[model samples]
Target chain A: MLTGAETEVVLLSFQVAGWSVLVSVVPGILLGWLFARWHNPARALLQGLVMLPLVLPPVVTGYVLLWLLGRSGPLGSAWHSVTGGHIAYTTAACVIAAAIVGFPLMVEGIRLSVLGVDRRLEDVSRSLGRGRGATFLRVTLPLSLPGVVAGAVLSFARALGEFGATIVIAGNIEGQTRTIPVAVYTLLNAPGGEPGVMRLAGVSVAIALVALLVAFWLGARQRRRVSA
Target chain B: MIEMRTRHSVRGFTLDVHFESAGPVLGIFGASGSGKTTLLHCVAGLLKPRDARISVNTRMVCNRPGGTWVPPERRKCALVTQEPLLFPHLSTRGNLAYASGAKDALESDSGWKIVDVLRLKPLLDRNTASLSGGEKQRVALGRALLSKPEMLLLDEPTSSLDAELARDVLSLLLQVKLELKVPMLFVTHKAGELMALADDCVVLESGKVISQGAPVNVLSKPRAIGVANLVGVDNLLRLEVLRHDEAGGVTLLAMGADVALAAPLCASAPGKTVSVGLYADEVMLCLENPAGISARNALACDVTRISEMGHEVLVELKIGLQSLRARLTPSAAHELGLAQGTHVVALIKTSAIHMLG
Candidate 1:
C-alpha cells in the first residue's frame, strides 16, 4: 500500500518543477524587463514565439524536444559527449521540457507588473540623486514582486501538469520518471484500478486548487495595490 | 544664467522656444496648448528637443548636434505637474520620503524632514490616493524639496484644485521662495494670480516669446496678450500725444482721455500717438462725479456689462468715447446697484497709468 513507487513519482515532480524554474528564472525576468521597457526589432516575433507552446499541441512540442535532445541528434550527441551522459530518458529532460513550456507564462506576468509601475516615479527617483540601478532596485522591483510571484507559481503549476513531453523524452520509468499525470494515465489503463484512480484524482485536485487559489490571491493583492 | 533653445516638431505644431533670464520666480504665462508644458519638459530633460542646447547654472543637460546629453535624474530639477503623481503604494509621509535622499544627522535643520516639512505627520500612515488634492500637491512639493533640487519646475501645480485649495498651495510656494534660495518657473495663464505670486513673467504666444521682462513691464505692453485679456487691462487706450514736459516725463491724450507717464514716452511730440494701459482694478468706479478729488482723469460713463470673475466682478463701462473694464467686489456692485446702461464715473489716478507702445 505504502509503495516507494508513488512517493518517487511525487518526489520526481517536485525535482523537475524546481529545476525547470531555476534554469528559466533569469531569462524569464530579463525577457520580461525587456518587453516592459524597450521596443526591439524582433519584439512582435519574440512575443509570438513565446506563446507558441500554449497554442501548439503538447505531443508535437514533446516530439520536437525528443528530436532535439535524442542521443543521435545534433545537440544531443554533442551534449552527451561534453557531459558524459545521455539526455533522453533522464530527469533533466523532464525539467528541460517543463521549462521550455513554462518560460513564457513567467515572463508575461513579470512584464505586466513592470509595465504597471509609473514612469513618473522613476523620474522622481532620478531627480532625487538615485542612479538608474538604484531606482530599479528600490521602486520598480518592489512594485513588481506580486506579479513575479504569481508568474513563478503559475509556472510551477504548469510544470506539475506536464505529461506528453515527459513521457516522450524521459519515458515512463515507474520510480524515476513517472509523475502525477503519467501515474494517472497508467492507473486508468490497468484493469480494476478504480481505487488508484480515485486516490490520484483526489491528490491532483488538491494541488490544482491550492495553486489556483494562490495565483488568485496574488492577482487580487496586485490589483488593489496598483489600482489604488 | 539659464537658457533653452529647441525645435521639436509634433504634427501640426512646432515648438521653437529660446530664452535666457535670471529672475528668481519666472511665470511661463500662456494659454493652453501654447507649448508651455513642452518647454518645461525640455528643461527638465524629460524630452530632448530634436536639436537643442539647454544649460542651467553651467550644467549642460543637452546638446544635440555633438551628442551631449544628460538624463532627467541627473538634471537635479523637480517637476510638479497638474496632478501630484504621488506614489499610490506609499502613504502621504512615505510619498514625501519617496524622493528623500541625503539624510544627515542634522536632517531636521535642512528644512526638509518627513515630520516637520510636510505637516503630514498625521497623514503619515494614510494612503496617498486618499488625500485631498491640496494635501497631495503639498506632499509632491515636499517630495521635490527633499530631493534638494537646484531649480523647481512647477507646471500648473494648483490648476487641479478649487480656489481655496489653489490659494493654500500658492501660500506654500510663497513660503518656499522666501525660505529657500531655490529658483522656480511657474506656468499659468492667470495674470492676477501671477501678480500676487510671480516676481517676473515671460509672455509666450503660440510657442514664441512675445515679451519677457519684469512682471510690471511685461504685463503693461498694449499688444501683449498677457495684459490685454488675462490682466483685464482697463484702459489700453490708443490716442494722440498732447504735451511733453521739459523733464523726461511726457503726457498723452488717449481716446480723448488725458494720460501722463512718470517716464518719457517712446516718441513724445505734439501729434505722436501711443497706447496706454491701466488695470480696471486701478481705475476706480465712483458713484458721484465728484470734482477736485485726489484721483486725476475722472470720466463720466455708463456701466455696460457686469460679470463675475473669481472673488471680484468685472464692471465693463462705456466711458468717455471708449468702453473700459473695471474690477469691483460683488458687494460693491450690489451696494452701487451696478447694472447695464447705468450712468457712472470712472476714476484713473495718474500714478496707476502705464505708458505702452
Candidate 2:
C-alpha cells in the first residue's frame, strides 16, 4: 500500500544498507580476527580505536566523517587531485556514514565468535601440514561462520536505522540519500505526512524484528558449535 | 630419530633438557609439571624456547638465537594431544582429509590401511560431535597419519580414556609401530605404557633428565630417587629365574645369596634375568617365622635402617645381599620392638611380586 515516493525511500534504504554491509564485511572480519588472536602489546589500543564508534555520539561521528571527507580535508583534497570528484552529500556518503555507525556491532559479534574457537584445533591443523592462512580458512573461518552471518545482519539492521550520521553527512535528498529513517523524520514535520510516517515506521519495525530473530538463531547455532 | 637441546622458562618454572634418540618409538616419562609436554612442544615447533636446537630425522627444524627456524607446517611432525581435537564442524571423513595432500592420501592404499587399522570405515560419515571418546581418538589418529608425517608426537594420547580404552589404544599403537613403522615421540606418565611401547626412554624430574636408557634398564634401576617416586614402587630389582615349578604354578627367582622368592608362573626360562616391582606396603614383618603359613616367602632378615614417613614407618631389610623395604605402622614397629640391626622375618605372598619385562 506504499505510494511510489514512499516505495523509493524504502528501496534506497535497502540499497544503502546492502552496500554498507558489502564494503564492511571483509574489513570487519579482519579486524575481528586481529582482536581475537593478535598478541602484540599495541593490540588493545587498536581495538579501543575500533570500538570508539560504539560509544561516541552518532552526531559527533558524522561530524568527524564530514571533516575527513570535506572539500578542504586531507583525504578529500587527495581524492580531488586523483579523480576530480567530491564525496559529500551523495549516496556514497550515506553508505559511508551508515557503515561507520554500524561497524562496532559487526566487529564485536565476529570477535567473540573467533575467541570462542579452540586454539588446539588450529594447532592440530598446523601440525597436519596446513599453514596459518590455510588453517584459518579451513578451520577457524568455518567454525566462526555463524557469527559472521549474524554480525552482517545485525549491522544491516543498524545501518537501516542510522539517521543522525546520514542527515549530517549526506543531507535529506529524496531518491538518493533520504533513507527510511530520514524520510520518516521529514514526514513527521509535514502537515499531511502522518499516514506516511506510520507506514514507514511499521516497515522498519518488521525489518528490525526479522533481523534480530535471525541474529539470535545464528548466535545459538554458534554456541552449539563451540560447545560441541 | 630426534635430537634436541632446549631451555625454556615460564614464570618461575624452567624446562632444561638435552637428549638424542634413535627411535621406533621414544617415550618421555615424567609426572605432571615435569616438562614432558613442554619438551614435545619445543620439538613440534609449537613453542619457541629461549635457547634451543632441534632436529628430526637429521633435518634441522629449529635453531634459535639467529639460526634457522622452520615453522610447524614444514616440520613434518604430527602432534596428537590428549584431547581428540577433531574439527567440530567437519565430519569424520572431512577431518581425515583436511591436510594439504590428504584427499589423495585418503584414497591411497596406505591411507585406507590406516582407516582399516583404526576401524574408522564405519564412522567415516558420522559427525565428529557424535563420536565416542575412543572413536574420536581413532579418527584423530587416522587424520594425523594421513598427513604422511615423518614422526608422530603423541602427548599422552590415551591418558584421557578409561583403563580398558587406554589398553586398546596402546595395542593399536603397538600395531602402528610394528606394521606402519612410523617413528614416534610418545609422552606419558604411565610406566606400563613406556614398557609396552618405547624402544628408548627418558625420565624427567622437575625440568631435567634424571635418567635415560632402554625402558627396562631405566625403570628397573632408576638412578634418581625422583624416578622411583614417580614409578610409585618402593622396590625395583633384577633377579635371575632359579626354576619354574609349573605343578605348583610358581617361578622361583633368586633374590641373592641362598635366598629365593616365588612369583606367579611366567614363560621366562630358567636362569633368565627378569625385572620385578614390589610395593613396600605388601611386605609384612613378623617377630618369628610361624608354621603352616600359606604365604610363600618368609625369609629371616636383619633390619638395616628405619625411617619414619607420614603415617607409616619404613624398614630397610638386608636379606642375602639384596635390600628390601617394608612399610609398617609406628605401633607395629613398637610392638615388635623393631630397630636398626634387629632380626625379623619378612613375609611376602607369591602374587606380591610383579614381573616387569
Instruction: Indicate which candidate wins on lDDT.
Output: 2
* Ten contiguous residues with the weakest lDDT in model 1 chain A: A1-10
Candidate 2 residue-wise lDDT, A3-67, digit = tens: 99999999999999999999999999999999999999999999888888888888888889888
Which residue pairs does candidate 1 place in steric collision?
A126-B73
Error of 2 at B21 (Å): 0.9
Question: Per-residue lDDT of B1-357 in model 1, one digit per residue for the tens?
Answer: 467788887777788878887767888887788888888888888776778988877678899977788887788788788888886666666666665463441156674443455575676678777788888888788777877787888988988998789878887788788876678888887655566567778777787878888665576565565434853444555657767655644454655454333324456566876656676777788788887787656778888888997889988888556678898888999998888998888887766776655
DockQ of 1: 0.42
- Model 1: CAPRI class: acceptable
lDDT of 1 at B292: 79
Docking class of 2: medium
Q: What does candidate 1's lDDT look like per residue over A140-212, in tens digits?
A: 8788888888888888889988988888888887766788888888878999867776776777777878987
lDDT, each prediction: 0.76, 0.90
RMSD of each: 5.9, 5.5
Tens-place lDDT per residue, model 2, B1-357, is 999889899889899999999987999988898899989988888898869999999999888878989899998899899999999888899999988798999999999999998899999989888899998999999999999999999999998998789889999999999989999999988777887799999888889998888887888764543554664446777889999999998999998878999998988999899987777889999989888999999999999999887778989999887899999999998999998999999999988888776
What are the runs in model 2 whose C-alpha is more than 4 Å off? B222-236, B243-251, B255-273, B277-357
